[model samples]
Target: MFITLVTLLEEVKDILKLHGQMLNTLLKNDSMPIMAIPDGVVFPLANVEDVIAMNEKCSDPEFMSAVVAMVGDIGGSSLEDATRRMMKFLMVPELQRHNELAATFNTHSQSCAIKHRQQDTLEVLDLSYNLLEENPALLGGLEKLSTLILDFNNYNSHVKFPYMPSLTALWLNKNKISNLPIIVEEICSKFPNIRFLSMMNNEAAPSYFNGGSLTQYVDYREYVISQIPSLEVLDDTEVQEKERELARKTYRMQRIREGSRKRKELHR
Candidate 1:
């Protein structure tokens, strides 16, 4: 019995270590090859070999979802150009094998048929941290998209997000936007199902300023909450119950200590 218990503990430790190593491998930057969508669904212009390997590995139907790179701005041109190329690549049927995909950063890929109301199967798309300069016009193409994550893109121009009737989650954070586009209001009015919306840190600092003022930050926060009614999560700002309980406990402790000290002084 003692020997069995010791062996079980060792086995559990080995399993945990194996799980940690697998997680590290999955998150490693060099593990997966980086590629662009217009170039290919799996690989951009440079990493065709990686794309092939990804396709072979991901072809297994057991895996529910797989991530792929959409487009990377090699030229760093206007958002319109980036989106155009992205759309061109998405047209390929081979790329859309998985209904769910976590895309690489800054893929402005659009669907022409969806734009024209021909076909629709796109369910999930995550394009975060691309520093997008324009809102892609192709958002209208995603008829079945339930979750759309377009966070950390700095767009100077007004890009519209319309025609996604099934959208639930939309993430728009860390942009250079000073004004919330009117189209966003229209989206709220049109789509009553939207549950999660985030538009945080859109304020641009003044040319000479070292830090943003409290007033400026609050104003932006208030504006976003007020604008989106269906929003469940706002600006990634959530107060955990644990933190609140801890604060309450700390306050009670301080009060008790103060009261004890006062009583001792009175006795003295």
Candidate 2:
């Protein structure tokens, strides 16, 4: 794109747009790669533009849904199709999300303590033993829901949950989840305020009950606690201050390296 400009002033104008007037002091020291130049310019021209466009699109949540709907009309798309075809394939239908919620908690279930069940009344919802798969965005309607239990469900590494800031406790015992990092990333993203979380009996969260070694269990707990600083308890074990400190100390350097790598990539 810069080469297509043809004029020298146009290229200079583009650099000035990024760095204002940095060229004034650094006239002789302006030899830098476009990516390593101003700010966090990790990508070269076209790729960075796409990243900016995607970020803008992400600001509107409904835009991606609309993209998925539109993209479904085209088959045999490339790996970079914005629809996330593989992820869409893994998730159950939107109607299924409603069906699962209805199956677990109905209008009558709310009479005991909560009302306006979809709004702020509901706090604890146990959707255990329901052969669940998708935790749809519809669950976000329960604004005040705190604890969500999905024990013995079909959740895996690909689980994409709705953002529930109020939720603190989550149980996913006896599930098919593996690939610890992927599942942990999804969990932390969706439930930023989670305090008590359990992924016991899954391959990712190995334990004595799950036929995994004691060393593996300790490692899992430390990793999880490190990833989620707000986590008070993991799997039934309390996250002590000493353990948390050790976990952070252990992963801090690794986290820094990962951050650098992510910055190098055009998209996060």
Candidate 3:
């Protein structure tokens, strides 16, 4: 009886070992489950070959969505090459359903030139830390885009906001902006639907705020909020009811002054 019990225990251990080996093999295989990829894997561009392999194992659309969501930047031998590769990858019909995209730390002008055939589904885009002097024509295609992050870019007075009727949020931190009035005018004209705006750490903002004094900051905030009535947030802070009231009064007075100036000019 003792001998039979020992043999049965040995058989159970062997079975458990075999099961562990099988699981490891499945995990190592290219056909591993999509969820197996760590959530922290933000940059799939760092391992394009692995992404390509995963595409072979999974359906193109599934792999494409996963890769698009994970990729941070498209790195290549050159800016043009990277842009071309990114365009080619994104042009895949299966990848069109992705709604969010990040193409930061790349040549913004070059990437913007690459016509994105799948712009319809894109709603949020991060183009930060790139060399973008002006609003690119590529934005015209992304009609549904609501959130655009252009932080750490090279935008200045020469840049104009593209007419994006659906844009609700914009991030312009750490840029070369020096003309607050021009930017506010552009927002009022081009982005009527904007609800959130961030212009922190910009050359224009600090200079306009007179070296970041609280009084100047409040004045700046009031001016911006007045310009864009739909704005609910400014520089990460929510617009309060009192602030809104002040903004409305300021806006009314500014309009009255402008009207008076225009009337005088017309008479002349």
Q: For model 2, what is the alpha-carbon lDDT of residue 161?
A: 88
What is the per-residue lDDT of model 1 for residues 44-111, given as tens digits with 9 covering 90 to 100?
Answer: 21233444454554445332022222123111133333333433343343433323221322232233
Q: Pull out the clashing pairs in model 1.
A: 35-44, 36-44, 37-70
Rank by TM-score, highest first: 3, 2, 1
- Compose the digit string of candidate 2's lDDT tens values, residues 172-213: 898899899998999889999999998888999989987999
The reply for model 2, stretches above 4 Å from the true place, is 1-118, 256-268
- The order by descending lDDT is 2, 3, 1
Q: Which stretches in model 3 have alpha-carbon errors above 4 Å?
A: 1-117, 207-210, 255-268
- Cα-based lDDT for every prediction: 0.46, 0.60, 0.59
lDDT value for model 3 = 0.59
**Per-residue lDDT over 1-268 for candidate 3, one digit per residue giving the tens place of the 0 to 100 score:** 1121112222222232334422322223223222334343332322434334443533445544454332213333433333434444433433322222223323233343223225777787766545567566568668898988877677885577679999999998888877888888987888889999999887557534336777768878888888888989999689998999998898799899999999999999
Query: In model 2, which range of ten residues has the least summed lDDT?
Result: 1-10
Candidate 1 ranges beyond 4 A from true positions: 1-121, 129-131, 181-192, 204-211, 238-268
Candidate 1 versus the native: TM-score? 0.42
Top candidate by TM-score? 3
